[model samples]
Target: MAKAVWKGTLTFGLVSLPVALYPATESHAVRFHQLQRGTTDRVRQRRVNERTGEEVPFEDVVKGYELAEGEYVVVEPAELEELSPGRSRTIEIGGFADLAEIDPVLFDKTYYLGPADPATAKVYQLLVEALAHSRRAGIAVFAMRGKEYLTAVDSTDGLLELRTMHWADELRDPQQEVPDLPARRRDFNRTELATAEQLIEMLSVAWNPDDYHDTREERVRALVEAKAEGREVALSTGAEPEATELTDLVDVLRRSLAEARAARGTGPKGGRSGTAGGSGTAGTAGRPRTVGAAGTVRAAGRPGTAGRSETVGAAGTAGTAGTAGTAGAKGGPKRERARRAPEPPEAVEDLGSLTKAELYRRAAALGVPHRSTMTRDQLQYALKAAARPRRKLGKAS
Candidate 1:
């Protein structure tokens, strides 16, 4: 189990519950230590006095509020500590609002909130269900490490999540920051707009965050591995982006739509032309030849008397039953083939190397209960346990 970053009492309407907060997010970015040029020695930083050029200890450092150029008012730590909110270690809910009212920009960091003790689990669960049913979030102020935070407490999948928020004044004015935005009264070409919308529809796919990955991080790791193996790292210069012309917008949209349709294996009329057996290319006698992941060709097998499927092996060898049916006399009536369900995730032998995001995905696929609150190790253990077959109980002797 992960240690809680903060332990405090949550209060609302005279009811107080003890809760522990655990950070809900982590960064997977690769990090590197500072090193000296042309040397293997690590570089380090230190604080020093500008006038004396002497290193200063952390204990001697004090907070300073600058009022003007070259002038500052030094403040003591004790004074700031006394002024911090939530001195009693409490997060009192100021009010509740519909979660949709909160803008995405206000949400900063996320943390999981759970009952501090097993005895309070009932109250915690009640609160979670209540928030979920009401579709509202408790807006509260929290103090941790002498810093006050505006937080939104909401429930998701039977677990409460607390998201720290930026103050209203902290948000920047987009209109002021961005100078080249199109005017609100600007008119757009109706034909070009329709083409763009059509292109978007053609390219749309289901949203699955697991399908995306950090390519830059993967490249960095590959670079490190290649350097360790004393291998040359191949580099490529990508083609420069072509400048788009507004006059050619419709042509560009049409080209993009065509490319998307081709990538998705759809014809010009947005229809697929594959056999009912599988999505493979056209085969002889109107029987589709399926290609397996291992480069094996599978000739669609007709249902045998024993109701068994004759599959092709990884060496591109076809089964006797499959070939006989597929190579039958021409002009034979088309037989209906059974459609298979989507393939399940492949069994993973080693789960320790996977990141938390990947483990979460696997847990979700395995239908593990209460996975939102589980740590990475807990998720791995749950997945392994779920994969185990249950032993049948023997009759008592």
Candidate 2:
């Protein structure tokens, strides 16, 4: 309504629906002033010439590519526009994709697609309704603001939303970045896998967006309040999934599949094992499954389902991914993480008769960083030293 970023005609088959591509989402993130710790003086950052230390204006800054140390190639805006790949007024429908192909990670910017002209409304509705009915996504290319974008168009609630995505090369190589993948794949077992899966199934349900919140974001706000009052901002060590590389891949995969199935509420008690095998994850509370002839087709090892199930942790709701169940929706590479729970605490010794607070203090003094994660009962034994610290076997009294 304010001003369209790019004006174009959405083309599907021979139908041309004139459309306005407007930004679909916005962030209301808060900003804060950087201040000196003791003086409360505001700290300011400036862009300056390295050699002269002269402050430079924002308009004077040019985008540059650094090829080597202290070496850069500055290119002008006009020159960049001249070399732009896709520059047109047409949103070309290159092809349609199974919605599952798109990875949530590759999604960059989203634009709401609306018919630009009154005459184009009919064809626009046709495309939107068709995509919604078929539950398919349109894989297309469009030129916007001198840049070419790979876009995915989905029709939701009578409006078409086009999401711009990253190219194949733009995505980072995970295989290169993560270490010890091979060794971690060697030692996993079936029982752990089954129990983990059972745990997931026992707790699985629908994804209500309201259920998830940025706890870190909320904590940051609380920290700000603490800072305003000049109180000790007690920091949380922050819960992170322990990274123990799996020693076995098969058990890893088996347990993961079971966990995902468990969250799926695909219990064999509710239905036959035959009905539950591949389709066990069907009937999730959020977004109903699009059943195929055999059953609901399962996407192998989706993101949250990775062996890193702890990544979602309590965020794992009882529901399915809704329309997002298809993992390969947009050429996003697929990888599986081995999801396993943390190991139990080591057994403690007897002769420990202290209050909980005192017991915790003893454990902290003994150098356990993960003490907070341990239960109070477990903490009691963890703090105990076996057999009253009996030094050497022969010299002990």
Error of 1 at 272 (Å): 7.6
What tens-digit string does per-residue lDDT give for candidate 2 at 1-397?
4578888777778777788988876664557799999888999989999999999988888888999998999987667666744445788787897444455557788778888898767888888778766656788887766678888888767889898889978977655666643432424454455444444433333222343344456678888888889999767574444443556433333434433443344422332221232333422212222222222223222222211121222321223423222221112112222434422223433425555555555555444323443445545645543222211222212
Residue range with the least summed lDDT across 10 consecutive positions in model 2: 303-312
Clashes of 2: 34
- Say which candidate scores most in lDDT: 1
- lDDT tens digits, residues 1-397, model 1? 7799999899888889999999886789989999989999998899999999999999999999999998999998767777864643888898997554466667788899989989988999999988876656899987788788899998787899998999999987766776775445425555555556554554443224343456578889999999999999997654334466777565544544433333344423323322223332222222223333222233333121212222333221233223222222122112101222223333535788887767776666555544565556666766665343222223223
Model 1: how far is 78 from its true place, Å? 2.7
Candidate 2 lDDT (Cα, whole model)?
0.54
Among all candidates shown, the one with the greatest TM-score: 1
Question: CA shift at 240, candidate 2, in angstroms?
Answer: 6.9
Local lDDT at 318 for model 1 = 34
Cα-based lDDT at residue 289, candidate 1: 37
Candidate 1 residue-pair clash tally: 0
Tell me the lDDT of model 2 at 132: 67
